[model samples]
Target: MLIGDVARRSGVSARMLRHYDTLGLVRPTGRTVGGYREYSAEDVRRIFHVESLRSLGLSLKQIGRALEDPAFTPSALVSDLIRQTEKRLAREKELLERLHAIDASTPTDWQEVLRIVELVRELDSPSAARRQQAVLARPEDVPVPAVLLAGAILTEPDTHVAGALRWALARSGGDGVATLRAGAHAEDAGIRRRAVLAIAEMPEAPGALEVLTHALGDLDTTVRRHAALALGRQGVAAAVPCLVSMVVEGCNDVDAAEVLGMLSLDPGCADRITTALVDELASPTADSATRIRLAQALVELAGATGQEVLRQLAHDDDGDVALVATALVGVLKERSLEDQADGHS
Candidate 1:
């Protein structure tokens, strides 16, 4: 076969076949009387072989070595090719993710597209300051995509950056709670905690309350405690038990006690919370330290219920408990007199 015929039969362009010949990758095996390049069957086979190897991402130089170098071992070259391909694949995947995020933003114009692109880039920046700035720079009216924000917040490890990201997500006014729910159920404990923290800040977001409720049962005490605190402030009675448990475990007990006191203002929760405190106080296994903390927590509860408990504890065997309760009783008495004086006036 002549060059044109070889190009036609093999589908390798004439120019490329000539280039291959020049590089000694596949040379013509013979020549006709007119001195045109002619390819024998074996030469055509070599051309096909070169094309096959090229399909595997082999460079022309590498293909030359592969076809002509008998001492060349493909195992090492093949391994290198695998590594290169994997790297390329990873880059492609990252590009695809960025594209998807940009597309999801639904930019109205080139400016919006650029803004979204810049935000995404900053969110993923290696510099923590840059990431923080990115979240803080978010416009109040233009919301970041919830899924993108969720992804960034879940992976953010820096304390400041994570907090900023959470604030940004909260302000997005989107259904970020559903996106965060994915992180809440993540296998990574850090991610789960981060997700709960972000959701805890979003009191008004749809489904946020439900997410916090579910988080109260998380195995990580930090998650449960944070959820309880947020829910407690939001007046969700579901947090009462967890708040009580935090007091028992001595984790954030003071804050828990304060929130519990606030919850007790509700007539419905007053009796139940008072009873829980009284039961814990009367537990035989509770040590003096536990009893002291519980005593202080009881001081947070207002009205006769808490005051009555204080009176009972005042006579207890533990001198410290008695001393603390005795002091609180005086404080409650002064406030009660002031209240009476104001009412009478």
Candidate 2:
């Protein structure tokens, strides 16, 4: 419904909605492309709940929590809202009963309210850090362009506050996301970490491969880890050789296995990867348990090719790799016989 329609139907004014926004009372489900508030049926239901409590003189905070969560059927959430509303309503009722006496006994204290309004002027009103200081300078005054600045953060990454999106390549989102394909070489560790996560979260683009390729040789282990993971998820054959190196070079077990699984699934490219992993299974690092675990992950890639890898794995110096390799080889023999029987069908 339109804000005007909601105002007529629910008896909540348009101005109150802005106040509610500051108090975190309610929010529109969405805004129209033309920039108008849009509410869904579920939003209307939450609004009605807020309206009922407010009519009983409940504070905005009391209604805000209940309106935010829907799984609030249990006591801890709903009962608390009801209790706050009842307590505030009782205080308001007493004020109504003593209205005449209170008015006669006390002069209105505009001084305290004005003092509070003056004190608030020193604290920042949130915008980008550049604008927050300006807003706080005059709290009673409307912060010029604060609303426009907020909308820019969503539409333009450059306008973002000090969070994930701000570091995005200037104003373009994917440009920043694509920045981390090359691992941290000269870049600061924190900057490279932030850039790597940003790019990995975004969908791959044609230019992203070069970045991913460059990252494979990065001096930093973690930046290389994220780059390997992204290449594996992208599942392009161009990444197989690099992923193999990552498995061979990486210290982190889970990431190596993830790259191996994705490498195996890269259609028609499976044979080369399986053959290499089989060769590595026996002679992988003597000092590390990660090698054996990586070999088992290779076995998953091997399937029938598992026999070759298992032979190497059985001879592995690591006791756990030898045991797991022997057991998997036995399982493969049974499966092979079953396949032979099914072939006659």
Candidate 3:
């Protein structure tokens, strides 16, 4: 077959076939009297083989080796190609995300586009300071898109930078709530933790309550505690059990106690919160320290139930718990007297 006929039948351009010959990738097996390149049946088959290998992302050099080297094994090379393809896909995905973030920002001009691009680069910078500065130093005029901030908070390992990113996201007027909601359900505990922390700071953000509520059931203890505290502050009674557990476990128990106190202001929650505290104190496994923590938490509750629980705790078996409960009862009595005096005045 002539090279032209092979090109026509095989879809390999003649120009490319000549280049393949120059590279010794596929040389025509015959020549006519005019000295034009000619291809035999075997040569045309080799051309198809070269095109087939190229389709799998093989480099020309690799393809040459694959075709010529008897010892060349394709398994390793194919694995390497897979790795390379995966890396390329990752880079493309990152670029696409960056573009989406920029478009979401709705930049008004080239300068704003450049600024958004620079901010995104800074957010992904290796240096923690640079990532933090990317969020903190973002010019007031060039608002960093909420999606960018949401993405950063989900992956930021630095505590300070994460806090700053959450602050920026909260101020984005809840635009990133959906991203955060997705993060809240991520299989990665760290991502879920970051998502809940960010959402906690944005209590007023749309869907923040729902995401936090969902996070309350997370398997991660830290994620659940943060969600519980945030929910408690939002006046969601669903947090009461976790908040009480926080007190019982001595995990940020003081803050949990404070939130419980605030929750007691709602008349509906007062008895339930008091009962949870009293139950923990009454548990057979309750040690002196655990009982003492529960005793202190009771002081934060409103209505007489908490005081009655405290009064009963004042005579508890554990001397330390009894002392603490007695002190709290005195404090509650003082508070009640103060309330009475103010009313009379």
Candidate 4:
């Protein structure tokens, strides 16, 4: 092992080991062609023994003498180590007993701890989607709501879970999409939130967009956020006006960001979105970030007229909105117009 690894293992600094080498207490067994020192397993054993002796209040000089092959009998060293180890074991056993007593008296929350450990294990397990699906299939064994929520959470970190989430989501609607919509109307907020999250993962799932919009209008923030996230995944510009209207008219900053994410995929649809943002930009209801995100979304969607529209928007009262608009203008201006827009068109 190298000096650092040895130092860390033996509780001796690498510098001290080099000093030990100078005193002939321990020396590297060999050197590389480039002259780097190397130690063998034998050297490690010797160094560790020296460190053990030093910790028990022996001087380095005394440790060196004790470590020398001829200076001390092997039986003497073995006996000393056995005595030290027994004392250490006695102290450790006392601590462990005290810990066990406290655990028994305090009512261990091992159930919660086990649940968390399982959750972490689920995250690390291969075929996690399948594992979640297996969990979701048995409502009698696993709480349906927790299993459903777990499946939804899995879909975000893993694409493989998308299919599993869709399976659970199908159970939400008779088809999953329809069920999620029904859940949105359910008296239980957890049902609605989980439903929204599940539906959002499968953007192309039938009736997903409509359910998401309905959820956005729901009195729940989490549902609205999931709706926005779903729309972004859907990448359908037809939903832009609805998103913009929600942002300009709604109170949540988070929802606006989600809708803007939708714009990233359809950069050709900006002009349609700009009309909506411009109307909202003048309103007291719209915030700077909201307006800017909408403007950026527009530029991304309307790559054709994005640059020109952005330049025109630069002088807008909403400074952040104008900045994003201008940046989009720069991106659109550099593209090859002939390649993207043919003369026949």
Candidate 5:
């Protein structure tokens, strides 16, 4: 077969076949009487092989090595090709995501497009400060997509940046709550914690209450605490058990106790909250430190049940528990007296 026939049949262009010949990748077996390049059957087969390898992302140099180097092993080279292809795929995926985010912004003009691109770039910057400034300075003129903000919020490490991202997410006016709820179930504990915490800050988010309620049972204590705190503030009685547990564990127990106290104002919730606290107090496995923390939490309760618990605790065997209970009871008595005085006036 001549070069033209070889090129037509093998799908390797004539120009590339000549280039391959020049590179000694595949030389025609001989030349015809007119001195044109002539390709033998084996040469055509080699051309087809090179084209096949190129389709798999092999560079010309790598293809040369693959075809001519008898000592070359393909396993290592194939692995390298796989790695390069994966890297290219990842880059393409990132580009597609950025494009989708830009489209979601619905930019009306090139200026809006540029601004959205700039903000997206800054959100992925290596510097947390840049990421934070990007979120804080986000163009209110054009709304940032909630999905984009949620993605940044979940992975952001800086506390200030995360807060700013959450704030942006709150006003993004889209499905941020749903995005956060999905993040709440992430296998990454850090991501789950961030998701719940961000959800907590979006008070107006639809379904946020339900998501937070579900998060209250997360195996990660940080995630649970954040969810429980948020739920407690929302007046969700379901958080009572976790809040009481937080008090026993001394994990933000002060804030937990305050929220629990507020929940106790509901007549139906008051007895339930009191009972949960009493149960933790009665647990034999609870250490003296836990009992002491629980005693401190009792000060936030509003009813006679809290006072009765305090009275029982005032005689406990742990000296620190007794001491705290006695002091809290004293403070409650002082408040009662003050209330009576105001009533008289």
Candidate 6:
């Protein structure tokens, strides 16, 4: 086959075939009477081989080494090609995400497009300060899409930046709840924690409550605690068990106790919350510290059941528990007297 026929059949352009010949990648095996390049069957096969390697993202120089160097092993080169392909894929994916975010913003002109691009770039910057500033300094006119903020919060490692991202998402008026719902179920505990934290701030966001309720069973303790606290504040009685557990485990127990107290304001939930607390105190495995924390949490409750529990705890075996319980009892009594006075007024 001549160069023209070879180019036509192999899908390698004539110019590229000539370039390959110049580089000794696939030289013509013969010449015709007119001195044009002619390719034998084997030469055409080599052209196809080069095209195959090129499709795998191999550079011409690497292809030369791969085809001509008998001592070259493909294992390391193939691994390198895999890494390069993966990097290219990652870049493309990032570009696609940026485009999607920009499109979601529905920019009206080139200037808005540039602003969205710059904001996306800053959000992905290596500097935490730059990322934070990008979120904070975003121009009021250039509205950021909530999905973009949701994606940022899921991957943000910096506490302050994550907080700002969550705030920005919340300010978007619950638009990113679906994205956050996916993040809440992520296999990465950190991502799930971030998602739950962001969702917690958007309590009124559509589907936010459902996401929190599902996150209550998260394997990550922090995720469950945050979800529980958020749910409790929403007056969801389902959070009572986790809130009581937080008190017993001493994990943000004070906040958990406060939320539990708020939940107990519901007449329907008061007895259930009180009973859960009393059960934890009664557990044989309950250490004095756990019992003491539970005792303190009881003060947040509204009913006489909590005061009765405190009164009993005041005479308990642990002197520290007894002392704290005694003080709490007096505090509850004072609160009750104040309630009576207000009722009279």
Per TM-score, the best of the predicted structures is: 6
Candidate 1 residue runs with Cα over 4 Å from true position: 1-97, 137-146
Model 5 local distance difference test score: 0.87
For model 3, give the 10-residue run with minimal summed lDDT: 170-179
Question: For each candidate, C-alpha RMSD in Å?
Answer: 4.1, 25.6, 1.5, 20.8, 2.3, 1.3
Could you give candidate 1's per-residue lDDT for residues 1-345 as a string of tens digits?
899999999999999999998988889989999999999999999999999999999999999998888999999999999999999998998788677767777778888778878888888789999889888977776658766787788889999999988877776655667768988998898999999999888876788888889899999989999899999999988899999888987999999999999999998898888889888988998888888888889888866888898998899889999988898888888988999999999
The segments of candidate 6 whose C-alpha lies over 4 angstroms from its true place after superposition are none
lDDT-best of 2 and 4: 4
What is the TM-score ranking, best to worst?
Answer: 6, 3, 5, 1, 2, 4
TM-score versus the correct structure, for each prediction: 0.76, 0.42, 0.96, 0.40, 0.91, 0.96
Best of the candidates, lDDT? 6
lDDT of 5 by residue, 1-345 (tens): 888888788777999999998999999989999999998888888888988999999999999998888899999989999999999999998788778777777778898888878888888899988888888876567778777888778889999999988878877777777768889999999999999999998855888888898898899999989989988898999889889988988889999999999998898899998888888888989998898888888889878888889988889888988998999899999999999999999
Ranking by lDDT: 6, 3, 5, 1, 4, 2
Model 6: per-residue lDDT, tens digit, 22-114?
999999989999999999999988988898999988999999999889999999999998998899999998888888877888888998888
Among all windows of 10 consecutive residues in model 2, the one with the lowest summed lDDT is: 143-152
Error of 3 at 110 (Å): 0.6
Cα error, residue 278 of model 1, in Å, equals 3.0
Select the stronger candidate by TM-score from 2 and 3: 3
Quote the positional error of residue 306 for candidate 4 in Å: 4.3
- Candidate 5, pairs of clashing residues: none
Evaluated against the true structure, the overall lDDT of model 4 is 0.61
Clashing pairs in 1: none
Write out the backbone clash pairs for model 6: none
